[model samples]
Target: MAEHTPEDKAARAAILERGCSTPIKTATGVWVRCGSRIKSRCESCAELYRGDWAAIARSGVFDGPVDQYRFYLLTLTAPSFGRVHRVPREGGQQGRCGCGVTHTTKDAALRGMPLNRATYDYAGQVAWNRDAGVLWDRTRRRLRDRWESVEYFIVREWQDRGVLHVHAIVRIARGEAPAAIELRDAARTAVAVSKVDGSVVEWGAQAQCDAFRANGDGAKTIWYISKALNYVLKDVATDADDVPVAVWRHQVALGDAARRMRCGVDCVPQDCSSLVHQRYGSRSQVVSASRRTKYRSGWSFTGLTRTVQRRLRREWWESQQAEAGADTSAVSPAPLEDLAARSRRELVARGWAAP
Candidate 1:
């Protein structure tokens, strides 16, 4: 390994403080110009943040802009894997031993250990992830065949490396009275969910049911769909050789960014925010009893109380809509009248009978 001399140490410190491309010292005590801010970044830090961004983006199935929630059943899914080693916790191997104490079982002994093992069919996992978008389409076709009310279910998968997960937002038309629960159940049943070796994929019915119960609203059926999709589309391997060049480049950039910044991908923005905060040296200050600090300048450019993402998204959407000559003002509006009207119909249909 190359030893970090004084110049190298100085360069690392400068990069850490000012970022990569800024001119700094090199190992030979020469000031070699580092990459520019545009081209230079902490690669590892970037990857981690990109991964986090991807996860959050995929979670869009769980929440969305107003007016569109009524028409979609968002979902996730995962591939099956064979059994492997076990930890004492996490419902690992529980068989008794001749020695009296419950001992951890071998890989072969735990062949049927109920879908917790990471030893998946690598090829199947890769293939599944690579074609998860297609698999989702097939599942949608199966769903339409089973349910008459279901005009179509739009299926999309978020590929986070080999871990092929899905994010399906099933779109239903207006004035449909399909039993959402039954529709979801039938879709699950019809879909050919299984391991590469042909073991039936374990549908997490309990979790899915729990999400719906917790929400306690018929309109919130999307929660169950979100849970189901998230459950099924668990981690699966991806073939490195099969990755596209562009994707590989993006992944590498993100990975490098992540490493240099010493932060996870989702936290990149946070990391950047933290650095900005440190630069400003500002602390939380409460102005009155009714209001506390919603956001600080250090954390973000325009810090506020709710939906930090809303502002960023709103701006982006505005820009896009403007370019496309679409109306941006009506994109997202929060009004009691609108909420009441939407809720009235849902409440009446659910037989709330509230005073």
Candidate 2:
């Protein structure tokens, strides 16, 4: 590691004070952001994460030609392994649960608990979660075959019952757009057989989709999809402190099922160290956006990704360091070439070279 100037030292200290709550100091006394995505774990980092994704979400809707595209907000859910108590959210419609008890907002903890724990298909639920990625791939392909000029950004979030729920914003060319219900029906009916376990996976009977125009009601739709990002940051097994006994048992059963489930075709549950088992059999990313291709402008037109964001921060820091050390004789550390940040600067300053 190279030496940093007094100005560079001051900048690092300021960052340490304002960034990650528990940042780790490198051996060279350099502090790096903890890179945590959980709000509870690190509010500053997580908020930065949320803001970036929110910008990406808005970019797909607002950055494009607003009048030329149609957007739809869609939610797809997992099939129920067994009936669970359906306690309404605060101020939601009060209804009698299957167990003959009317659960109110006060009974929020019991929302996803099984009425008959003995019969709840914890194994089936975990298996479905593990295979959710495959199912979505098939669904998206199906949607593309059905619709023209399809593009999307999807988020996978946890339901109170520890199952994954998908929220997506789908975009299509204006002239080729279909009704929201048609898209929902096609997505809900799409199914795939898991290659890992050869079991069929499908969405639940319930699905919701609503179409909005970028020049019209698209902002509301973007906000709705972005709101689901809050749950995306949270761990599936989080918030276990002081929970009801039933809720704890429910989570424990799901965890056990996930642990015992096979993550790969040849996976041995007892010895496999895959984190999928720890995450309730969920191996998919919390959020996914389409990538830019030669033919299609997917997700963000600027091609913003977490890597891009990190590189931006590093570039800014390197610029500060270079400026501070201008009067000093010490050579500044070389920036990462693969990041292209330093290369772009070198090109602008000295022109492209074969070497």
Candidate 3:
């Protein structure tokens, strides 16, 4: 890596101090906004990420021929590996823990920690996380089979117990849509035989489906689902300092199990360098939306996506510089792959100092 010049350092600092707050240097040696969805990593970029997805979520609900369709908020959970304490959210009611103790909000650290760590089935938990995507794929196929017009946007979240749980915003033709309970039942009973190990992957009994009309209640439903998706890219590992010893041990056990598990059928656990092991067997994007296909309508009516969003931002910035009469004659309109090696003049034209 080459050392940055004084002017380049100033330019990078300007980007970091102003909009990005946490600019990351790419392999091209260009300083740019860190496009992380995790708030702890980059708050500005994370909120922007959340807002962009929320807009897309709203578009699927409010835009297009929504009157002819019905919307549903569906949630599916991972099967319990073992019993855990039920500590409600702050300000909520307290309940008796399985260990014969009335636990309060302060006991929240133990909320997802197994009562008996010795028999918690950590291997099964990690394996389930690894195959969660396959299970969801099977579930969506079943839904599409039942209702041909089904389209969805799904967000997978990590539970405190280091397991993956899913929430989906589904759309189907009102004519073909059945009752909420029926949809819930079908999704709950859906199963997938993992290609990696041939083990049957199934959802937990806890599932929810709530029907909401696109016109009257669509906005509220969109808000709820988007809020639920806010934690999509959050790290599953918890800081041991604030948590109890058992909870810390639980997370360690999960990490150990994930490290030993083969990510793919051909993967050698000992030699593999995949980050899935570091993330407790979870891999793949946390947020997923249906793509527009030949015979299918996607989740977004406006075809809004992260790629589109980035392109639009670039276009908007170029237009702004054009309006300001910034000279771009020195800069070549490079291909997408070469854009990362941005010219100093281009950065200066964008109102940032550069060498």
Model number with the top lDDT: 3
> Once superposed on the true structure, which residue ranges of model 3 sit more than 4 Å away at CA?
237-241, 322-355
For residue 194, give model 3's deviation from the true position in Å.
1.3
Task: List all candidate RMSDs to the true structure.
Answer: 20.7, 8.3, 6.0
- Clashing residue pairs for model 2: none
Per-residue lDDT tens digits for candidate 2, residues 28-133, read 3444455456777778867777777877777777876768878888899999889899989867999999999998888887888888989999999999999999
Model 1 error, position 329 (Å): 27
lDDT per residue for candidate 3 within 228-338, as digits (tens), equals: 677665767663347778877998899899999989999999988676787788775788899888877799988887668767776776687699996433221211234
In model 2, state the lDDT of residue 19.
65
Of the two candidates 1 and 3, the one with more favorable TM-score, higher being better, is 3
**Which candidate tops TM-score?**
3
Comparing 2 and 3 by TM-score, which wins?
Answer: 3
lDDT of 1 by residue, 105-218 (tens): 332232222233133343334334333434454655665565433432232333343233333344332344345565556545534443223333332232121122212463
- Candidate 2 accuracy as TM-score: 0.84
lDDT of each: 0.35, 0.76, 0.77
